[model samples]
Target: MLWPDPAQRDRLVEIRDNLLARIAEAEREGWLGEVEGLQMSLAGAEEKLTQLDRRQSNRSVVDLGIPAPATRVVGAVRNKSVNSSAAHTPVSLP
Candidate 1:
């Protein structure tokens, strides 16, 4: 899942801690390969948690009864002078 719910977040944290412990144990036992793999997995988990946190912080569900304000289009394509000329162009060419 791209963004997991609260329960999934809890599970991910639990799994991450377990993997970290395993990585430490592997390092103590001189199993460098296993430790490397577990470290990569832990990094992935941490990244996912960061992404989820960012998404949650940046999103909001607002309900405004009235419509939103109209947006003004600027730049070459939608400038007032260009828009006036563009409006006269025919859709289909003979």
Candidate 2:
């Protein structure tokens, strides 16, 4: 497990428990729809947390000594005015 540290593991468990409690409370309050949404959100958060833990445990620095290519900007950019008339009109570029 990436979270070999006891403190980090405990924090993750605390967060999971808090989310579960919130779902339960929502259910008890008869907010079925809200509870469902909350459950989905909590599941996503848990999955991300697990992935992060794994990444932290297996992180390593490797220097390949390769230079990255320079980025180039292309194409003309135009800015449209918000809250303007919907009618099509020629916009002059400065």
Candidate 3:
């Protein structure tokens, strides 16, 4: 599975959340066109999320040395470090 880098993942999550909120507001304001646009964006955001998950399987472990260093992802790039929390947070969707 290919996982998105941390920054990309975070951006995707943010986009999804914003889209949801905007969609809700559009519906309330009776703006059908706006609602549709927001819905489409929401769908794209969701698709990208799925793609990210399909690409990355954190469950899969790779060994580089005797002691494996912790890894962090930055925009689909992987960086290894011992103490970094930024690499672990993935977008959790409902």
The prediction achieving the highest TM-score against the true structure is: 1
Worst 10 residues of 2 by lDDT: 1-10
Instruction: Name the lDDT of candidate 1.
Output: 0.84
Which 10 successive residues of model 3 have the least lDDT summed?
A: 1-10
The TM-score that candidate 3 achieves is: 0.55
Off by over 4 Å in 2: 1-15, 61-94
lDDT of each: 0.84, 0.77, 0.83
The C-alpha stretches of model 1 lying farther than 4 A from their native spots are 63-94
Ranking by lDDT: 1, 3, 2
The whole-model C-alpha lDDT of candidate 3 against the native structure comes to: 0.83
True lDDT of residue 22, candidate 1: 98
What clash count goes with each model?
A: 0, 0, 7
Candidate 2 lDDT, tens digit per residue, 21-93? 9999998999999899889878966876777677777889989898999878798677768855655667789
RMSD per prediction, one decimal? 10.9, 16.2, 25.8
Best model per lDDT: 1
